[model samples]
Target: MFSIPLVILVPSAYGRMLLRLANTVKERSDIHLQIFAAGNDWPLEKVKEMTEAGIYKGFKPFEQLKSDFQQADAFLTVMSFEKAEEPFMKTSFTTKWLDYVPYGKPVFVWAPDYSTAYQFAHQHRAGIAVSEDDPVALVKAMIDAASNLETWQAACGGARKAAETVLNAEKIHTLFVDRVNHVCRQSQDTPNIDDLKELAR
Candidate 1:
């Protein structure tokens, strides 16, 4: 009975990966799939292709993102499926994952085995992480998320906790300010490198 949308908001850099994931879930009648353009650089053809294929409603911006996400049945976060991008995946966390967490929605991430985002999701119990190379695994996660309300709610609670504790904007900014202040204090106490070199000679 959860007939809302499964939303994906991406920066337009990973159109092919989005398409692959959308295609896997296109046929579900229980929910619709929507891809929202996060930034301005999305490929026009890829957008057109998804629309034509009926995998996604279309690429567009929501009038109110928070409200839109609140209404969504679930969320998606994905990384590139290419083996060449494995190094990037291993080190990076997608912004979409952070954005989705605060909404308390069940998130599905398709990422490489070594991805930090994948590991974080699994560790925090915040979302479901599927191997990017395994379409079946992605499909199964989707179905499992869609079919079970209790599990979905539990994931949402975990995601909300993660957003509040680790990814909160205030906490991150405070940490940044503290680090900056520490560096400034250290610089004030340390002798200048040029002075040290001159003294050595």
Candidate 2:
């Protein structure tokens, strides 16, 4: 059985989605999804239910989580399709992306088309992106990723390139400095204090 580890935070918002995917995969494939619930938001009842059902693998500390990642075949992350989350999901990137990329393991993203997760996967080709909310589609994506070594290798290579280029700290710092300098240059022609006081009056 291929073990795919997922570290999920804020279970109140994402727990159901993860359950749906896990149940579907359980019914359809030999994939074993080991869910490590992080944060304090997970309700005890839900955790108990999933734990008994063999879906929830309990929480791991940072060191243990890193060890699990090293042992796992791949990684998974998701964005909720709930309408209330759309605005935030569209603009925000998951930190899990950063966490998984460094491992060079296949990162499977199940998210809506508008989500940053999907966009990042599409942009960098760093992971498999299943834009649809269908569990079957997500299952197919996972199966494809597991079966095709060349595809995942290429994706991992793209992830490496992204880490080396756009995600590089030095490059980002340079960009920030350049932008600040441009803004300072533009502000050079701004009105003096007396002109500002007159305008306020």
Candidate 3:
């Protein structure tokens, strides 16, 4: 008797892909998707067309993101259509997941097992990760999340903690500054052209 509607916030580029995964649950009556995308990739007319055809409920503007996020139950983060064997899928992490974490929302990650993004979801326990190889697995993940409300709530809290500890912007900046300072010190310690010439002799 899960009554909360599952609202998934997805970029237009990812909305369709996620729909493929959601086909199993789209008509469930308790699930809804609010897709927002911008830029030349998704024109206004195209957005309208997708909705009219019932591809999704509709497209929203980026302006509505924060308000929409506040209303939504969960977030979605997906990778490109490539399968597990693709080289890029093995190492790349979708930054969208990090964005979702800071919101303290439960996320459903659709990525290959080899993807670092999938690994992060598992390691942090911030969200559920579904294997891209099995579409049914994705659907099952969604249903399980809906049924296990308490566990998902805890995951949301974990998401916020993981964001602060592992993906903090200030922490990243400090690491970058440290690397730059180390590089400068190494350059200063290196011999000048005259010293190099003498050593060669």
Q: Which candidate has the top score in TM-score? A: 1
Model 3, span 1-201: residue lDDT tens: 222222344544355565564455545565555444432234556556545645444445445556767676777666655643357767666766655666777787777767777878888886788866565777677677888879788878878887898877678789999999999999999989898999999
Q: Candidate 2 residues 12-105, lDDT tens each? A: 5677778777667655446878788764344677667667767688767877799888888788889989899999998988887766777777
Q: Which stretches in model 2 have alpha-carbon errors above 4 Å?
A: 27-29, 39-46, 52-54, 169-195, 198-201
Better of 2 and 3 by lDDT: 2
For model 1 the local lDDT of residue 22 reads: 65
Cα shift from native, residue 89, model 1 (Å): 0.8
- lDDT by residue (1-201, candidate 1, tens digit) is 343344455544466666565666566665466666543344677566667755555444555666768777777777766777778878888776666777777788777768887888888887788875766677777777777888888888888888898877789899999999999999899999999999999
TM-score of each: 0.81, 0.79, 0.75
Candidate 1: residue 45 lDDT (0-100): 75
Q: Among all windows of ten consecutive residues in candidate 3, which has the lowest summed lDDT?
A: 1-10
Model 1 poorest 10 in a row by lDDT: 1-10
Q: Report RMSD for candidate 1.
A: 3.2
